[model samples]
Target chain A: MSAREISRLVVPNRGQSVWLVLLSASAMAFLAVFALALSVTSAQLARNWSAALAQTATVRISAPPEEIEAQTAIVLEVLRTTPGIAEANVMVAAEQAALLEAWLGPDLPLDALPLPRLIELTETEEGPDRQGLRLRLAAEAPGAVFDDHTRWRRPLAEAAGRLRAFALVSLGLIGGVTAAIVVLASSAALASNGQVIRVLRLVGARDRFIALAFVRRISSRAFIGAAAGTALGMLALRALPEAGGNVHLLSGLGFSGAGWLLPLAIPPLAMVLAWAASMATAFKLLREVT
Target chain B: MIAFEDVAHDYGGGPLFREVSVRLEPGSFHFLTGPSGAGKSTFLKLCYGELLPSFGVVRLMDRDVRTLSRDALAETRERIGVVHQDCQFLDHLSVEQNVGLPLTATGRPLREADLSDLLGWVGLGEQAEALPPTLSGGERQRAALARAIIAAPNVLLADEPTGNLDWEMSQRLMMLMIELNRMGTAVLIATHDLQLIRFAKAQVNARVMRIAGRRLQIAGADL
Candidate 1:
């Protein structure tokens, strides 16, 4: 077929169906992009939490006011002298008060609050094993209790890991749905154009030529639709406010780093979908006719 | 050329015909005349590779019909043109577009003026852009003829070329057929009109073949 002839069929008849596909694809792209963003964000957060808690330990000492300062100093001295000890600092009164502000209101009078003396322990690159350090800390600083942030960090990291897994699962489902929709649309077109096939066949056209007409028509439309959809999705992502900005909740949903490259694939993916769908539909219909 | 030897055919165990043998030579015209139910259409279909014989072989252009691939058969069909009585068409297309269908289908370059020329030969140049639904019976027959020969096929098989035309109209169509024969295109027309055959015999060396009792024989003696 000539360029004029190809345009005559592909351009005119695609009004409603192409619109439907574009609308569906845009919606799917929006969800799909968000799903990928969430997956990456969750994995990043999980990794950050895991690494931060792996080496650090906090010792909270509770004693009489006269002995509290001395006990904290003793704990810091023991940590600094220990093997794999990088540095140890006795947390000041103000530092302890700032830490309490997260749990209680900052305006609360420190005189009225029974806060413990806080001591920070940092490990070197050759950090001591957490199990061995815990035993040593208990023996040297009997009044001191160590908190590795393990109790809080484990569940938080696990939840983020699961969320990333869930987003990946959702992406898989979207891809499956996209393939299924294209197949159905292609099959319907084949059924409606039955006479076109017969006429072409009678005039010495092989099945490949007839199938190519349909494939070219559908694949180009799908490519256009998906490109438009991906553009819209990227635009929506751009319109979104940054994290810690006015729209605090939605800010976490944008692509980062190499993630922006994923949306660029939608158009080609849709082209493949059209080719697979139309070819399968054409050959299946041909079997019925011949 | 098409040859069928000891060909047997049956339509679902009904109206079976056996041991039918015949040969169609190049540049020769044949008329398949018989009663309405004598498998005349079936015989025509077999000659054109539409139906396969039950027991024997059918050779269209020297190749076994059963062994021809779909594309090969499609290429074979390009050499053979068939015009059914109904003259079905895409109603959305104009008369000229309908006539140039064979050219478009086979990837031939379509000339705009050639469409008008074909319509002119059929006396339908004035109705070039008219849709098929608007054409009269005589006009549709002419359009069908224009469609059949647009690709200049070697064989033209028309089933009832003038079934609904008046005496004058039938003569017009017959003249066109005779003109095509003169141009070395073999024509096979199937009809029950004995009068049309008599009119055709005057202009050319035509032969009358009767299809009766599930057999074929030449019979111009009665006329």
Candidate 2:
């Protein structure tokens, strides 16, 4: 039908559960935004952690204060001479104290503690062979232990990957729930308007024609409600404190730059979902009644 | 053009009508009359493809009704107009919109002048902006008639169009049907109102059929 003509046959909205559809769509969109944000942020964190830690290793030398300098120099010599070692440097006392402050508080007496001297190692593209490096450090620099940080970093990266997956699964569940709610609401609407459908059919209205009236009504509502929810979600995300200097998961639970555009698509997707739900329900009901 | 070939319809309990053979040719006018609960409405439904015959084939526009798909059935319905006994309407809509629904369904453009003329002809011009529920019994029937013929269907099937109207209103409705038939549109009206049938026969050469004892038969010149 012509747009003007179809507009005249407004689906009767009285007593139909339209509010349920709107509320469900809004709630779904709201949760979808957060899920998307969480997924994006976790993905970024996983990438960053994996990239930063993959090509780096640490050497800790523990010995008497008089022997610490000699052991550190010997560990650096061994690392520098290694085949896959790109660069190796001994960390200054101040740098070691700053790293230790995060764990032992700022007021700890660094002078009296028997701290281990640290050597940072950067690997080439082929990376340092862990087995060879460990054997070399044990033979030449017995006081030094090679640490790849994989014992803890790998688990952290895996946890970030799992969080991203969980967020994606939550998003899918939200979409499925939204569709189910819309189906129920549209079915209720079709049932309540049984007489109206009969009249339309009697006047030679096709099933598609009758279905368009209802689909348009419900999809428009979903679009409006989803738009509102998306806007609110974006605002809520924007109001959160910036990640700043923190290195934790909760601090990174937000979007940045082009990532904001992802949530903008929710409204249109909700509109399409609502249209399909209403169209299917309307045609099914019309078939039984006509 | 609607044709029934020894069609039989049953409601699972028993057969409501059997061996009902009839043909509605182009430009013909027919009146279906019978006593209460004699399956007049069922016969009308069969003619409009609303109910499938249980035993034999029914043809609409020369195609067997059984083979017509859902979309095909809808397309066939566009060529036929039906009015029910109670005059069903989307009560939320105004009378003007309700009358123009056929054009809307068929995707035909609405012309203000044509709609105004049709409403004026049905004597519902004054109630054009009023809702269907706000209209009187006669006005609702007239509006229903206006909607039925808005697309200019080849055949019109109305079940008890005057069942709820007064004597004056019944005559008025019959006159509208006669006017439509005079314009070469086939009309089949199912009703028990013999007086209305007699009034229509005076204005048009109408064939009268009656359903009795679960069968349909052409009525003689008794009335």
**lDDT (10s digit) by residue, model 1, range B114-164:** 877878999998999899999999999999898888888888888888998
* Model 2, residue A150: C-alpha shift (Å): 1.5
User: What do the candidate models score in CA lDDT, each in turn?
Assistant: 0.76, 0.86
Candidate 1 residue-wise lDDT, A1-290, digit = tens = 34236323422264355555556666666677677767767777777677777677777887787887677777777776678877777788788888878988789898677778777777787875667767776777677787878898989888888988998998888777777766676676667766666556655566666777777777777778778777877788778777752212257566666878978887788778768876887777776675
lDDT of 1 at A269: 80
Q: Which structure among the candidates has the greatest TM-score? A: 2
Which one wins on DockQ?
2
TM-score of 1: 0.81
